[model samples]
Target: MSITLSIIYLISTITFVIGLKLLGHPETAKKGNSIAAFGMGLAIIGTIFLNNLEVPIFIYILIIVAILIGSVIGWLIAIKVEMTKMPELVSLFNGFGGASAALIGIVEYGNNQADITQVTTIIAAIIIGSITFSGSMIAWAKLNGSLKKDIRLPKYNLINNLLLIALIVFGFFIVNGSINGEIIIYILLLFSLIYGILFVIPIGGADMPVVISLLNSLTGIAAAITGILYDNMVMMVGGILVGSAGLILTFAMCKAMNRSLSNVIFGAFGGDSVAAKKGSTIGGHIKKTNPSDVAVLMNYADKVVIVPGYGLAVAQAQHVIHELEELLTKKGVEVSYAIHPVAGRMPGHMNVLLAESNVSYDKLIEMDDINPQFKNTDVVLVVGANDVVNPAAHNDPSSPIYGMPILEVEDARSIIINKRSMNPGYAGIQNELFFNQKTSMLFGDAKETLTKLVQELKNM
Candidate 1:
C-alpha cells in the first residue's frame, strides 16, 4: 500500500511540474490548470484510501459531503465571477486555502500529544495560516472597493512590530512545552488573526496584487507545514510549488514597479502618506481628438501598437478593441498589443482580457519584447492605460512611479489615448503622456470609442 501510494505521489508530482511549465504561457494555461487539478484529485483520493488511518464510516461520509458542498460553491463562483472581479476571487480563494491549513493545525494539535518538533511546526502553521486567511480577506475587500481607504492607526509600524514580537514570544513558549493549554492556543490564534488584519489593512487597493501574491505564498508555506504534520509527500510538493510560484510572481510584480518587496510591505506605497505627497500635477496643454481622426491616423500608419490597462477592463472594451485591430489588419497596417507586466489590476490581467476576446496570442507583446518596436511605429493607441505608459516614470525623479518600468509609447511618431476623463490612474498620479506634444486624447467610454473607431475605418 505504501509503495502504491508513493508511486501515485510521484506521478502526481510529475504532472504538477508539467502543468506548471504549461501555465507559464497563456495559450496552454487552461490545459495546465486542468492537468494540475487532476493531479491534485489523484493525490487526495490516494491519501484518503491508502493512508490506512482508522476512520469511522460516518466521519468519511461527512468528509465527502463537505467536499461536495465546497465543490459546488467553488464551481458556482468560477462560472459566475466576471473577469473584472478575478483579482478579488483569487484573493478569496487564497484565504480559503489558508483557513483550511489553519483548521488542520488546530485539529491535529488537539488530537495528538505531539513532540516538541511537531508542536513547533503546528504553531508555525497556525500563525502563518491565520495571517494568510485574514490578510487575504482584507485584500479581497480592498480589491472589491468595500474597504475604500487604507486603515491605519497612529504609530502603525510600532504597534505592528510589537504585536509581531508578542506573537513570537507566545510561539516560543508553546514550542518549549511550557504552555500547552487550549486557552493559550486560542489566544495565540487570536493574536495571529489580528496581526493578519493589521498587516494588510494599511496596504491600499493599488498594491493589492502584490499583497495577494505575498499572502498566497504564506498560505502555501502553511500548507507545506501541515503536510509535514501528516507526512504527506503530495501535499508537501503541491504546497512548495504554490509557495514558490507565488513568491516568484510577487518578486516580478515588485521588480516591474521598481519597488523592493520590503518597500511594498513596509513602505505602504499606496497609503495616505503617498496620496498626500501626490500634489504635483503634470503641466501642459491637453490635446483632444475625435474617434474618426484617430481612425484615420491608424489607417495611414505603417504599424500601430495598442496598450490596454485597468480602464479597458472597466469598460469591457477588449472585444471592440479586437475589432479595431481586425479593421487595422485589413488596411495593411501592422497591429500589436504592448502589455506591461503590472498593467491591469492583477498579473496577466490584460492578457486574460484580450484572450477572452479571441485576440491573437502572437500580437500580444511583452514590455521588453515590444519596447523596441515603439520607436519605429507610426501610431501608438493607448486604451485607458496610464501609469504603465507614463513618461514620469523615466523623466520625473520626484514622481512616485519614477523608477518603475513603463511602456515607451511616447517614442512613437504619434499617440492617441482613449479615456473617459483627464483623471489620474490607480497610483493617483498625473500622467505626462496625456500632455505630450505628439499625444492626442479621445475622451469617452473605451468600448464606445473603439466601436466608433471601427465603424469609421469600415466607412473609409
Candidate 2:
C-alpha cells in the first residue's frame, strides 16, 4: 500500500475499533453500528479507487445495478421484519458475509496467476469461508426451527468429525493443483455445508446464543483470511476486530452458562425436548393463575422484575411489556428487567427489542446484576420466558442442562408467568420454575396478556 493509502486504512481501522468498543454497551450501540458502517463504506471506496481497474463501462454499470438492488432489498427486509424474526435475519446476514468472503477468494484465485503462497491463501480463504458460510446457514435453520434439534442419528458425532477432517484433506489437494479439481472443490463445499448442519443439529435452542457468537467469529476469520490474501490492510484490521470481539463475547457466554465450547459444540448438554413428556404434569404440579389475578398481585407488590425470552420475541410483546412495566411503576411499584445472556433467539435479543421499544436502557440488567436482586423482588414477572428460569440447572445432576447457570427468579417472593400453554420450551425441557411454590401461570398470548394486565393494573 502507498503512504496515502496506508493513512486511509489506518483511519478506517481506528473507526472500526472505536465503533466496536462503543457497541459494548447498549446506550451507544446505534452510533456504533453507524460508525462501523461508515468505516466499511470508506474502505470499499478506497479499494475501488486504488485497485486500478481497467474494466469496461458496462461492467461498471452492472456493478452499480447490483449494489442498488442489494441495498433496496436489504432496506425492505429491515423495514418490514418483526423483531421476533430478528434471529433468522441475523443468521441470514451472517451467512451472506461468509458466502461473500469465500466467493471473493474463489474469483480472485480464478482470475490470478498461481504460486504456492498465493495458492495457500486461496485454499485458506476457501476452506475457512466455506465453513463459516455453511455454519451460519445451519444456525439460521436451527433458529428458525426448520431442522429438528437432536443427534438425528446414533454415532453421527464420529461421522461428522471424520467428514470435517476429510474436507480439510480435500482442500489441500485443491490447493496443490490436483488435475481438474473444480469438481472436487464443489463436492467439498457440499460436504462443508452438511458438516455445519450436522454440527449444530445436536445443539438445542438453549445453546443458540453461543452458536450465534461462535459463527460470527468464524465469519470474521474468513474475512481476515480474505483480507490477507488480497493484501488489504483495512480488511485485515477490521476482520481482526470483529473476530476478537465475537470470540471474547462467546467465551463470556460459555462461562456464564458454566459450560465449555467443546461441551456445547459436541452437544453434551441442552437436549431437553423429552423432559416434559417423561416428567410429571406441568399443570397438575404448578399453580394456574389468571392474568387479572396476576395483575392484582403485581399491583399489590412493592417490586416487580420482568424476565423475557424467545417466546416474548415470537409474540412481539416488548412494547406491550413496556406498558405493563409503566403501569407497575405508576402504582408505586419498582419495576426492572432481568436480561439473561441467552435470553432470546440471539445473544442480545431482549436488549435489542427493549431498546427498539424505547425502554429505559438502565432498566435492562445483566444476569449477574439482577440475579441477587431477583431474590428480593416481590413479584417476578416472566413474560413468555422459559428455559432461562429452569431450576434443573441449579440442582439436577443428570439433567441435560446440568452445570448450566440460570436466573434465580425462582427465589423471588412471587412469580407470574404469561404463556399460551404448558408447551415445553425450545430446549424441549419442562421448566421447573413454572412449578415452583410461589409461581403462578397465566395462560394466553404474551402481548394480549400483558395488555390485559396493564388495564387491570390501571383499574387497581
Candidate 3:
C-alpha cells in the first residue's frame, strides 16, 4: 500500500512539473491547468484512500461532501467571472488558498500536541497564511474599486515594525511552550491578520500586480509548510512550484515598473492628491483626430502595432481590436499587439483579454520582443493604454515612472490613442506621449472607436 501511494505521488509530481512548464506559454496554458488539476485530484484521492488513518467512514463521507461543495462554488465563479474582473478573481482565489492553509495548521495543532519542530512549522504556516489571506482580500478590494483610497496611518512604518516584532515574540513564546499555547497562538494569529491588512492598504492601485504576486508567493509558502507538517510529497512539490513561479513573476513585474519590491510595498505612490495633481499637469495642446481620419492613416500603413491596457479591458474592446486586426490583415498591412509586461491590472492580463477574442497567439509580442519593431512600423494604435507608452519614463528624471521600461510607440511614423478623456493613467502621471508631434488622440470609448475604425476600413 505504501509503495503504491509513493508511485502515485511520484506520477502526480511529474504531471505537475510538466503542466507548470506548459503554462509558460498562452497556447498551452489551458491544457497545463487541466493537467495540473488532474494531478492534484489524484493526490487528494490517494491521500484519502491509501493513508491508513484510523478515522470513521462518516468523516470520509463528510470530507467528500465538503470538497464537492467547494468545487461547485469555484466552478461557478470561474464560469461567471468576466475577463475584466480577472485580477479581482485571482486575488480572491489567493486569499482562499491562504485561508485553507491557516485552517489546516489550526486544526492539526488542536488534534495533537506537537514537538518543537512541528510547533514551529505550524506557527510559520499560520503566520504566513493569515497574512496572505488578509492581504489578498485587501488587494482584491483595491482592484475591484471597492476601496477607493489608499489607507495609511500616522507613523505607519513604525507601527508596522512594532507589529512584526510582536508577532515574532509571540511565536517564540508558542515554540518554547512557556505560556498558554492556545492563548498565545490566537494572539499570534490576530497580529498576523492585522499586519496583513496594514501591509496592503497603503499600496497604490498601480502596484496591484506586484502585491498580488507577492501574496501568491506567501500562500505558496504557507502551503509548503502545511505539506511539511503532513509529510505529503505531492503537496510539497506543487507548493514549491507555485511559490517559485509567483516569486519570479513578482520580481519581473517590479523590474518592469522600475520599482523595488520594498518601494512598492512602502511608497504608496498613488494617493488622492497625487492623482489630482497628475490630471492638472498637462502643459501642451493634444492633437485630436476622428476615427475616419485614423482609419485613413492605418489603411495606408505598411505595419501597425496595437497597445492594450486596463482601459481596453474595462471597455471590453478586445473583440473589436481583433476585428481591426483582421481588416488590416486583409488589406495587406501587418498588425501585431505590443504587450507590456504589466500592461493591465495583473501580469499577462492583456494577453488573456486578447486570447478571449480568439486573437492569434503568435501576433502578441512581448515588450522586449516588440520594442525595436515600432521604429519600422508606420502607425502605432494605443488603445486606452497610457503609462506603458509614455516617454516620460525615459526622458523625465523627475517623473514617478522614470526609469521604467516602456514601449517606444513614439518611434512610429504616426500614433493614434483611443481614450475616453485625457485622464492620467493608474500611475497618476501625465502622459507626455499625448503632446508628441506624431501622436493624435481619438477620444471615445475604446470599443466604440475601434468599431468606427472597423466600419471605415470596410468602407475603404
Candidate 4:
C-alpha cells in the first residue's frame, strides 16, 4: 500500500476505536456512529484513488454504482424502519456484512492468487461468513414472527455436532489442497449454509439476543479473515475491533441471563410454543387496575421507577412513556428507568428506545444499579416487560428462566404493570410478578394507557 493509503487506514482505525468507545454510552452513540462512518468513507475513497492498481475505468464505474445502490437502500431502510423492527433490521445488516465477506473469499479462491496461508484464511472466511449470513437471516425471521416455533429434530444435538465436525474437516482439507475440485468448494458452501440454519433453528425466542450477538461476532471474524487474506490494514483493524467487542457483549449477555454459551447453543431453553407448556402454575389471582388508579398511585409516590420491555416498542409508546416520566418528575417524584440487560429483543434495546423519545440518559439505570434501589422505591411501573421482571427467575427452580437475575420490582412499596392483555411475554410464560400482593395490572395498549395516565396526572 502507498504511504497515503497507509495514512488513511491509520486514521480509519483510530476513528473506529474512538467511535466504539463512545458507543459505550447512549448519549454519544449517534455521534460515534457518524465518526466511524466518516472513517469508513475515507478508507473507501483512499483505496479507490490512492492504491496504485491498474483497474479499468468500467470496473470503477461498476464499483461506484454498487456503492450508490447499497447506500440508497440502506438509507431507505433506516428511515422507514420502526424502532420495534430495529432488531430485525440489525440482523439483516449483519447478514449483509457476512455475505460480503463470503464473496471476497470465493472470489479470492477462484483467482488462483492465494498461498497456503491465504488459502486457510479463505476457507475460514467462507465457513464463518456463510454461517453468519444464514444464521442472521433466521434470527430476522424469528424476530419478525415469521418463524414462531423452535424446530428441533430428534437427536438434533448430535446432528449439529456432526455437521460442525464435517465442516471443520472439509475446510482443513481444502486448505491443504487435498480437495482440488471446484465441486468440493461448492459442497463446502452448501454444508456451511445448512449448518447455519441448524445452528439457529433450534434456538428459541428467549435466547435470540445472545444468538444475534454471537452471529455478529462471527461476521466480524469472517471480515478479519478476509482482511488477512488481502493484507488490508483498515479492514483487519476494524474487523478485530467489531469481533472482539461483539464477543465481549455476547458473553456479558449470557452472564446476565445466567446461561453459559454452551447452554445457549444446545439447551434451546425458551421454545416459543413449548414455553407455556413448560411453565408450572404460579397460582395467584391478579389485581387489575385502571389508568386513573395508576395515576393516583404515582401521584402519591415519592420515587418511581419505570421498567420498559418489548411491548413498549411494539406499541410505539416510547414517547408517551417519556411524557409520563416528565409529568411525575414535575410532581416531585424521583423518576428513573430500570433497564435489564436482556430486557428486550436485543442488547441496549430499552435504552435506545427511551433515548429516541428524549428521555434523559441519567434516568436510565442498569439492572445491577437499579435492583438495589427498587427496595427504596415508592412505586414500580412495569410497561410491557415480562421475563426480565418475572419472579420465576428467583423463586421457581422448575422455570426455564430460573436463576436469571431480575429487576426485583417485587421489593417496591407498590407495583403497577401496564399491558394490553394477560398474554404471556416472549418467553411464553406467565409472570408471577403480576400476581404479587402489591402488584396491580393496568390492562390496555401501552401507548393508550400511558397517555391516559399522563392526562390523569395533568388533571390532578
Q: What's the C-alpha lDDT at position 313 in model 2? A: 85
> What digit string (tens of lDDT, one per residue) describes model 1 on residues 53-84?
78888988888899899999999999999888
Worst 10 residues of 2 by lDDT: 269-278
The all-Cα superposition gives candidate 3 an RMSD in Å to the true structure of: 2.3
lDDT of each: 0.87, 0.79, 0.88, 0.89
Q: Could you tell which candidate, 1 or 3, scores higher by lDDT? A: 3
Better of 2 and 4 by TM-score: 4
Task: Give each prediction's root-mean-square deviation over alpha carbons.
Answer: 2.2, 2.6, 2.3, 2.4
TM-score of 2: 0.91
Q: Name the 10 consecutive residues with the lowest summed lDDT in model 3.
A: 271-280
Could you tell me the lDDT of residue 152 within candidate 3? 88
Residue 35 Cα positional deviation in candidate 1, in Å, after optimal superposition: 3.3
What is the per-residue lDDT of model 4 for residues 1-460, given as tens digits with 9 covering 90 to 100?
7998999999999999999998777679889989999999999999888989899999999989999999999999999998778888989999999988887877778875348998889889989999899999999999988998889998899999999999999998888787776677778888898999999999888788889989998898898888898889888989988999999999998998898999899987765434555435666799999988888889999999999999899899999999999899989999999999987898788887888999988999998999999989998999999999988888878777889989999999999998889888887778878888999999999999999999999999
Q: Model 3: per-residue lDDT, tens digit, 291-321?
A: 9999899999999999999989999999999
- Supply the TM-score for candidate 4: 0.93
Error of 1 at 426 (Å): 1.0
Candidate 3 segments whose C-alpha is farther than 4 A from its true place: 25-31, 271-282
Stretches of candidate 4 off by over 4 Å are: 25-31, 271-279
- Model 2 agreement with the true structure over 1-460: per-residue lDDT tens digits: 5566777788899889988888877679889889988987787667656656577888778877887898899899898988778877777888888888878876776765357677677767777777777777777787777765555557777988898888778777777777334555567667777777777766776677788788888888878888888787887888877898889988988887777888788764544344545465344477888877887788788988999987788788888888888877877999999998878876678988998898998999998889999778999988777878888777876666676778899879998888789887766777778777888888989888888877887777
Look at candidate 2 and give me any clashing residue pairs. 272-428, 273-428
> How displaced is residue 245 in candidate 2, in Å?
1.9
Clashing pairs in 3: none
